[model samples]
Target: MRRHLDRIDQLILAELRHNARIPVAALGDRVNLSRNAVRQRIERLERDEYIQGYTIVEHTAEARANVTANLFVYRTDRMRGGEVIAALKSVPEVVICDVMSGEFDLFVRLEAPSVDRVRAVWQQISMMTGVRDITTTVTLSTVIDRT
Candidate 1:
């Protein structure tokens, strides 16, 4: 399906991406539209699920000290698919999960407070039932995090 977004909609999205709490009046001023028009557009976007919801991104001190680890997991068996997914979800350190192909069955992105914590997470994953092998790469720096 092709969803067409006008210039005003694009402006609204761009503004929201920068600051979701910006007032509709300010947004209207920025986009050169009436406040009512901006409000209507925002409502439509929300109703159509284009704009899901507003959220805040907190930068905690602990997070500043943390290191991110990306893990590529190859599973030995497909029979325990649900179990594997459930286990992944149970690990709070696993911040992102995706089912992948090629040499790996799953890819996971995790954050730990320190290198020791990353090592502990790797050990925990190594002990999982059907995980055949795990390859981990530590990110030296993050140039972009669209999320």
Candidate 2:
């Protein structure tokens, strides 16, 4: 069963999302709760699997200047394309590859140093067995990234 979150829970989640390492007392100050109350709520949230994990986002100049692209991939055999996925995993530029439904079998997101590098990675993916077709789209800008 799914759990329904109230306003306080939502606010706590928002603050934690912005900074997972935020102190319980600071979080309580923001949410109008006591420190122990906030700690208990956080523990419950984790126990309920609402707070799965935390991670850091890179803000380096090299990371910001990288070329980003999305690839809509059509596989010859969607059910048995583990080899293709493994090959993609070997490519350092491949950031995310998600299995999809509907017309596309896979959606791949990659970041590389330059457009030339993007092209090279694209060619490498296109030549992989079981990859029937790939449609690549380069990102011009990211206007609103809450993450």
Q: Which digits, one per residue and each the tens of the lDDT, describe model 1 over residues 19-82? A: 8888989999999999999999988888878888777677777556778999998888855665
The reply for model 2, stretches above 4 Å from the true place, is 1-56
Cα TM-score of candidate 2: 0.63
lDDT comparing candidate 1 with the true structure: 0.86
Positional deviation of residue 111's Cα in model 2 after best superposition, in angstroms: 0.6
lDDT of 2 by residue, 1-147 (tens): 447888999999999878888988999999999999999988888878898766778878877999999999999998998888999999999999999999999999999999999999999999999999999999999998786
Residue 44 of model 1: what lDDT?
87
